[model samples]
Target: MRFKLQTDYALRALVYMAAKQGENCTTDEIAGYFQISAAHLGRVIRRLQNHGYVKAIRGRRGGVRLDRDPESVNLGEVVEVLEEGAQPLDPPTGEPGNGVDDALRLKAVLRRAHGLFVNYLNKVTLAELVAEGLPEPQPAQQPSEESAPAEPQPTVAAEPEVASSPEKTPEPVGAPSAAPGYGRPGSPTYGGY
Candidate 1:
């Protein structure tokens, strides 16, 4: 359920690039802005480049840019490209006849749920996330003295206690006084003492 730091960095770098639009941004610039290591950023950029998410240029004015429009890129696709062997859950492993078969069935169900989640993500693009503009919160309205009073809260019902069987009763502490052979016929204390 957790993403690696590299994936997180890659997403941040992509967002920065998307924000810049047509401008070319250098790894050093991104590292400086995010306070990350330049060497780490360089590696992240290379991975993005290999995944066709970014295009790198070489020269004095050269840097990295998004290969495609932000609207055309899905967040899930970006995650897949940036993450290696990244999955929502681990695959099940076990022998056929063992109880592992049941575990594998449960894993399959979980995998299906994960697939649905990924499908939802695939439907949303980065542009959608960026398109949401910030709005100011509205102030709360004051209640008038003439307004009706709120209704009282309802009381919760108590649960009934269940009685236990005689066999389940616990013995009294320090109440027993019996020797190993006290009840035996041949013992020193045969019946009563």
Candidate 2:
């Protein structure tokens, strides 16, 4: 099934933003990038901004940024928002005889098909879709002591590499845990990772 042109442009913008880093995107930039009309794209940007997907900054060099993480933005929800009143078939409205029952059955089949389509789309996140083309390469992260052990310790019975069983090394102490209510509500870091 085909989406409206507006939805297509919005998806393109979303994917482009997902592939970018740091700098916000300008409507002119998006228009230039896609070779679409700036005015038409302006409307699309406004619609996306209204839906909490993009946020516009006001200034001379101002531009829009992806407000929510790509993974959190569901494709089905995006389609739903963009295609609110544009269903493929009219729903089953109760009416007697004359192939109306057939219409109802077709509508039911369409609904099931749509359900399956949306479920499949929901399973595939935007992050997964854009992973192959992330704008910049991120630095490799160092594994933390809290997350994993420093090194593998060979057992005494399986003496393959080591001559003797070495003494266990102590794990480095981690930062102190936040005290009760220390990082609770009213903190700047609240709701942050």
Candidate 3:
């Protein structure tokens, strides 16, 4: 039902690389573009390199590059590999067969659900994800002389708009304390970054 942080980071980094069309990029570049921590992304990049999904180049003009073609990299395969050992249902704590039939059945169901999720992702590739297009990088803002030091003016605050339906409502900044299936920040369940 939920992916680990590594999985999310890997997918995001891959998509960014795929969009670049084989151009090499630094971990900090990708992290900055996504507004994520470069340190965390660096670890993810190392994992990706170890898996042969990417290669690292050392030198002033070097950076990480996708080793495989975007079309050949399956999203499902990436997720399944990165999410290995992440179980929705933890193993029974007590002795086996100690009123655990229901738990066993639930584990089987969860496995099947996870399989379905991967199956859906298998139909998509990194190339397809990049084909959707990414947002353009924002340029740094510079103050202009015309906008310099204006006199303060009193203004009335406008009321916030209320949506008629929950679906129409905008999500609050920083999300909720814990997302539906995600854990709270800094917790083990917290999706990495």
Candidate 4:
């Protein structure tokens, strides 16, 4: 299911703050980095501030900082808070039968699916989201001036190492080859493709 733009912005801002390690950041800074409108981000920040997830400071050298620990911020809870009153499927109305029952059943299934989705999100925390270091900012490249050519260094060729058994190489016991957050090979959740 798709989330509202404001919900998406709120999550992005939180992730940025989490990666910043408690450093205060301005809305303009975040908006500029994300290439979004500062005014829209400001509204999202205000909502976050009202929810006590972010604290806004006033005056000089003022900015917003995360008010709570990253570990305490559950992704599901954040989504729920930011998406309050948002209905994924409209409630079925009118008398029973005549396709109304089918709509009601579909709504129920959607509700259950949404609950499962949120449950999965609950397993993830803000800290986990930012456990990896932030991406390095790219600097603008400058044009190089024409200069004298330099000689290239000499290269050495090496033979590739060969396994003792050509048919198959032995893998370490209990070693995980799959990426994190994904099911292991042979598991039900594993996407073999």
Candidate 5:
């Protein structure tokens, strides 16, 4: 359910590049703006270059720029490229056919859900995200005290205090132990004889 910080940085870096279309962007510039590590941004830029999302130029005035138009770049595709082998959920693993079928079933359901999420994302392009003419933020209005709902107070339960007296520790494995009353050898309540 959580994206890696690298993914977030990749998106930011791409956005910055897209916004500065026609202008070459340096790793130091992107890193400085985003407050990220320059070395890390360099790695990200290199990966993007390898993936054809960006083109790097060399020279005193050279830097990196987007290879494609912002409108043509799909956010979902970019995310996929950046997170090549990432899975939102871990694969299910447990003893087979021993009441573990439910866990496997849940895993399948979650996988399907994640697929649907990605499918929705695929429909959105980066152009939509970086579009100009965004709606302005509305000013917040102070609510009258009489009209405002009272904040709910959280209830905290007191925890039972443990005595400081030292208790007897259980016998270690392979050590001998006395049997308890009314229990057969190897019973669940007592250690095995």
Candidate 6:
């Protein structure tokens, strides 16, 4: 269920462009804003351009501008395109029919959950993401780990709470893993993740 950082960068870049309207956003600009790599963001920008989300301008004023309206771009569709790098699930294997039925059931559940996720995203547009304006405070030019001077550590806070939407209800917790002779420390057949 994890998404790569490239997806995060792509969405951020799009939001920046969507907010800018006519301004062309450069990879360097986005990279500096998000404290990410410009080269990596450039590759993401290329993929986005190929998918018709943006058009890249070359030369002195080289940058990317939104090709389609923000409202016209569905988040789900964009996520599908960006998730091309996700590894496909390997088919059920080993132990002839030992867990084929269970595996198939699990696969079906995974597929259904994934479909619901994407379908939910489909209802939202890029416009909604930028409606509240860009996030702040604008980050300073980030110093590299080695060159940056160390500062006093701040007290860590508890995990932030998230507001749940009325449109969705939480699923019940599932049973714990039933791997035989596993989970317990120093178990004979324990396999660490």
RMSD of each: 27.7, 15.6, 13.3, 13.4, 23.1, 14.8
Q: Estimate candidate 2's alpha-carbon lDDT, on a 0 to 1 scale.
A: 0.66
TM-score of each: 0.60, 0.63, 0.66, 0.68, 0.64, 0.66
Every candidate's lDDT: 0.65, 0.66, 0.72, 0.73, 0.66, 0.70
What lDDT tens digits, residue by residue, belong to model 3 across residues 4-26?
66676787788788888878899
Model 1 TM-score relative to the real fold: 0.60
Task: Compose the digit string of candidate 5's lDDT tens values, residues 1-193.
Answer: 4455566567667767787876898999887775667787798788888888889989999999888888888867877787785775676577888747887788788888878867775886556555542112221122353258659766554444554777655554444235422112333222110
Model 1 whole-model lDDT (C-alpha atoms): 0.65
4 or 5, greater by lDDT? 4
User: Taking the tens digit of each residue's C-alpha lDDT, what string does model 4 give over 91-153?
Assistant: 888889788999999998998889897888788777876774332232212113113344665
By TM-score, who's the top model here? 4
CA deviation > 4 Å runs, candidate 5: 97-99, 132-193
- lDDT of model number 6: 0.70
What is the per-residue lDDT of model 2 for residues 1-193, given as tens digits with 9 covering 90 to 100? Answer: 4566687667667767776753688988876776666787789889999999998988987899888888898777887899784666966566569788899888888878888877776775556546644222112222243367548654443333443568554333342233322123333222111
The most accurate candidate by lDDT is 4
Q: How would the candidate models be sorted by TM-score, starting from the highest? A: 4, 6, 3, 5, 2, 1
Off by over 4 Å in 6: 85-88, 95-97, 136-193
